[model samples]
Target: MMEQNQSGRSLLKQMTLREKIGQMLLCGFHGTEASGDIERLLTEVPIGGVIYFARNVESPEQVERLSKGLQHIARGRGNLPLWISIDQEGGMVARITEGISLMPGQMAIAAAGSLEDAYEAARISGLELKSMGINMNFAPVLDINNNPANPVIGVRSFGEEPEAVAEFGVHTIRGLQDACLAATAKHFPGHGDTDIDSHLDLPVIAHGRERVERVELVPFRAAIAAGVDAMMSAHIYFPALEPQRLPVTLSPAVLSGLLRKELGYEGLIVTDCMEMDAIAVHYGTVEAAVMAVEAGADLVLISHTAKLQRESFGALVQAVESGRISEKRIDESVLRLLTYKAKRGLLRMDADEPAAVAGREKDNAMSLAAAAPEQAERVERGDRSHLDVARRISENSITLVRDEEGMLPLKLERTLVITVATEVTTIADEQLVQAPTLGSALADCGLEVVDLTVSPEDVASDSARLLQAAEAEGVKQIVVGTYNAVNPSGDPQRRLIGRLNRLGKPVAVVALRSPYDLLAIPDASVYVAAYESRPLAMQSIARALTGQIPFAGKLPVSLK
Candidate 1:
């Protein structure tokens, strides 16, 4: 067993009720630097930490300064250095985009089929983050993507199999924690197998207790065994766990009963963004925050809006004073939070005085300026190595699921490429088109490229019309690239490909996002699941198509 640190215990003994309550709340603020509003929040509410989103990130230097500024203010107020957190889960959900290397996400790593690759990916990500002053990363999603129709967690998960998810998730946690960056296994017990996107609406998992244990909870249990630093609760409702239909974020049956007692996870328990529609549309933000803390969440995340943060903070104080929430409950979570900070050496700062804080800020600025080039050099070296892994992984992950009549290694000299821009929801509920240009990837290979946008309302007829026009111009080889075609609106692309097949033109389907798109368009002459459309993946796809690199990838998830 690990020995408890004296600093955390001593600090806990000295904290007032408001400070302890503040420690439980993870609040969000705007801009890249500490603003007046943020200073006010630190002074009044005095939150435990701040969560950064895409809006808060402008550049790597800005982020380092922003984090240091926040910490400087916190130390000035005689509090523990704030836990600066972010959702840097690469691929679609990367917040720090400019300086950081874009990873092929969880599914690609799983597709690469190497635990070392998973570990390296996390290590590279953690190193970049630590240099930038961010301490915590919400990543290595343990949710197994067993359902093809799952809206939110398709590619974010490692794979469909529980064992693969567990293996990769454990390696990822070790990689992050070893680099001194806290890794959070998220959306427990699991957010997979649901067709709904919880950001827009609440999803319910109808699995019975036995089935839940057999499937959804498998990776979570493995995460606990791996000594994950934190676990983020899902807003999804699981009827088998809680018959009252309360989302797991507010259910003691799942959070306390299942996660704590049954599964034995001793790390910090965090609630997903309370501003998301799953919680916000159903209940008031303050009510939900109180309930989440009551349900055993050590941290309640309010990712946006100052009004909601104030209300939630006020509600927690009132609840503690009115005896609605016990002081012991607050202390339990505060102790865990402090221990985590101490473990990260956040509590190792010198004497907490105004002069000390000012000196620390000046020292940080000087040190950061000096360290910026070294940090940039580290990222440059890491990026080179990581991109090589990405290329090798991409080369191996482009699974040839179906190829009838030997249509692959296409005769690119006579090919016509059509990229279908479909709505894909990666980071938010609002769908954005997968806009990677395939023409450039295949340009040097002598393939003709045509970009076409098909609305969901008229995907079939419009795509067919475009294909017919290409055929009229004597284009025989058809290559169709699609995004989000597997989960929801797949039939349109399938129909368009089928129409080309009927016309005696060989069609090769490249699944830009999900590998399971082959299930919807099974009859294509050839199909390649690229898993993700990162530049390296796209380049690999072009190479695979023209026989420059062999299709070396195997399917991580069974299409059948």
Candidate 2:
């Protein structure tokens, strides 16, 4: 029998210098199909993993085939099994949408008021991803949502409190790992307190070491203690950690000294996408890749730009040969990568198999057999039973911040549903097309729903026209779907609400995304914080509006 304790060194000894360096990169490709570039990438360059985005995904079947095809190529090329990763964090940052159950985001789980629920949501999310052969999820964001103006992480966070974040994040990590998937606690030390989105530009976190340890590092410490498989570095600059204000992705002090030595995180450290402007704007792609590895990141994530990926690979190869990067450093990361793959049964390929057409076909057949059950169970995961959890959680997350006039539970008559979401925006990706709005759900509840779509800039004119029509139709009340009413774009919604109030009409405002919307538009007669605007959230809002369900959820985040 083979030894149970096969050392990483044993695996490292079998690899060439080029293969060792190739094991550090995690890249993303353009097409849905297995193109020649991707084939070459897996066979020749042989990156450690590939990350998927909405652009690369079309359906569950497509993703299954894509993942299997990539794995087939990797196995056929005598490479270690690829780590197929995605940001399947549910709510907003979900890459696999159509066939997966879109559960509420982190804050919603926290707001649902149960650690068990948080774990279950993650378990289901992991199940859905693993079914598609995706082994890594860049999820369970350990960031605490302390900043109201946080452009990227609002609902993506668990809550504003560090303890709550730790409590929920730990369970979430357990859930993902339970399903044979690796859970990644991300944006360390923390990206929650910043108001800027790092994708567009770098944001500086000017906290002292004391405050940083006290607040920002709380959940990350908890995550490490919980035994998370991976942690993704944030691109935000920490002035306290390094006087030069280097981003954590390129900071040895942060990644090595703090996360590794201080926190004692033995798992893999994956960098946020190198293609983001936060890193790419300052250091060139090749320079950034070299620096990330030097900074102690086990994996450098370059999610797009194939040209930059090739350049980065060449630069790493040159750096290793020129003694700029020690061979030992390369071995250290490769060991971690091999050890990780070994644990996940990725290194269990047949030795006698040829690395050609026969091998590829056999691997493809095995993958298809494994993926069939997963695809079959896809619809089952989103069945009525699972959706009930969403409904219950959504209803539980509905925080009633204000209802002074108590205009809720409006009778099913002459109620105009004015949803002001001409275009929805999320930090992950700009959603050009609006999803099904709350008007349809309200209409399902027997209310006379007058759905009027309006861009934030056009809200004034749109409101005027809509209100006039409502008045002519003898509409008695208004329900506004304030998706991002706290954003600068929501100025027109505030104006429209003011106009409606002056007209002596009762307005029930639904804060679709963030609970901070209540702070922005305080004058509304009735206020409900749905925490999300997904269909389940819409159903919860509908139920809450018509008095079908009670507002049982406590405010996870402070409105003050």
Candidate 3:
């Protein structure tokens, strides 16, 4: 191990200026395959890494092929092994959806209230990602979702409590690292209290250092203590941390001073995509990439636009040549990059070692087949074991907020199920699996069901029609699923529930997204919080409603 580490440092000393600059960049590109611009970047510019989005993924086989092809290209050019990364944070933020374990979101895991579950979910996710040749996962969001009004980090967060978030986040980090995949605890100093999405515009946290320390920085401290491999910077501004109101990604005070010196984190510091509006709209993409590196980010990520990627590479090269940014600073980052790669056993296969590269690929395939044969088989068949784990967690996470009128265990033979169509609440959420209608699950429980799906905008106009349909059918029980109904636009859903109450039928409301929906509709006689609108969650909700499974989940966040 000592010799390997020394060799990595020795290799860094032999690198050219452009090669050292490339080590600081992690770029993204279009298409499912690595060709054209992506191939050119690998051969000429020789970027350090690549991040996968929904656009770059199709299936496990395709992803494996793409990852292997990219690594081959980099190796062919006598460059270091590429860091193939992805945002497989589970739930709505997942990139590789098909043929993998789709674990419950962070909030759902918290609601389940088991640290073991959190660890297992991440371990499973890490193993599968490793099988596909993805070395790093930008995951285990350390943000505590303290603000009910937060648009981006709601379900992605573990919970509102600092300690609970810390415990779960650390366990997730351990799980991923134990599986030999790097886990990134993200969005520091915190993104949990903002209503605005950084993908759209800059958000600010104006709290003093004391308050920020108490809430926002708790999970991050715990993550650092756990030896997390990477930390992704947030685009949100922290007034207390940086007086200039710059995003944390570009603020030296926040990234270098606070995170590095104060917190004592020695891991790789990666910036969130430079193309995000919070950075790009305010500062040019090429400029922000340079600023992020200057701010102490070891890796500057540009997730879209190949033109900007090339420009940013050239700009960084020029920055070093012109003495705007010292070559020594570039070498510092490259050294860190090489060290991390060496630690991960990524530096063993040099360009001359084709047999070693082929052996590594064979090892990955054999490990997948031997260790997780069931998982591999499930990829070809249906109903993966990981889904069973996901379903079990979902079942445990179904919180019975209230059942005032004793409406649970649906006594009626026939029921009416009303569901609101789901929308992508934030740019982070891909909404891969449609939340299956509750009617089918309920029907499987022996209740005759009538299903109705309504758009959020048309709910008010269609309320009367729904009521008439319910009355004409003589339905005595109604179950409605609400998705993020705490927002101002959810007034129609609130009013629709009010109208349904007057019909004299037992109305049970299930919050399919945010658990805070009951806070907006306090008059609801029977309310439940499913925490998410995914298929497993919906099925779990259906089971809980019929008493097939008990509501074991406790509220991770306060309803008040």
Better of 1 and 3 by TM-score: 3
Pick out the ten consecutive residues of candidate 1 with the lowest summed lDDT. 364-373
lDDT by candidate, in order shown: 0.78, 0.79, 0.83
Each prediction's RMSD over C-alphas, in Å, is: 4.1, 3.8, 4.5
lDDT of 3 by residue, 438-477 (tens): 7777877778898888877889889988888678556879
TM-score, per-candidate, Cα-based: 0.90, 0.93, 0.93
**Error in Å for residue 378 of model 2:** 9.5
Off by over 4 Å in 3: 1-5, 349-385
Model 3 Cα displacement at 235 (Å)?
0.6
Candidate numbers sorted by lDDT from highest down: 3, 2, 1
Candidate 2 regions exceeding 4 Å error are 1-5, 349-383, 422-427, 430-433
Q: Which residue ranges in model 1 land beyond 4 Å of their true spot?
A: 1-4, 349-382, 422-435, 445-465
**Each model's backbone clash number:** 1, 0, 0
- Model 2: lDDT of residue 142: 89
List pairs with backbone clashes in candidate 1. 396-553
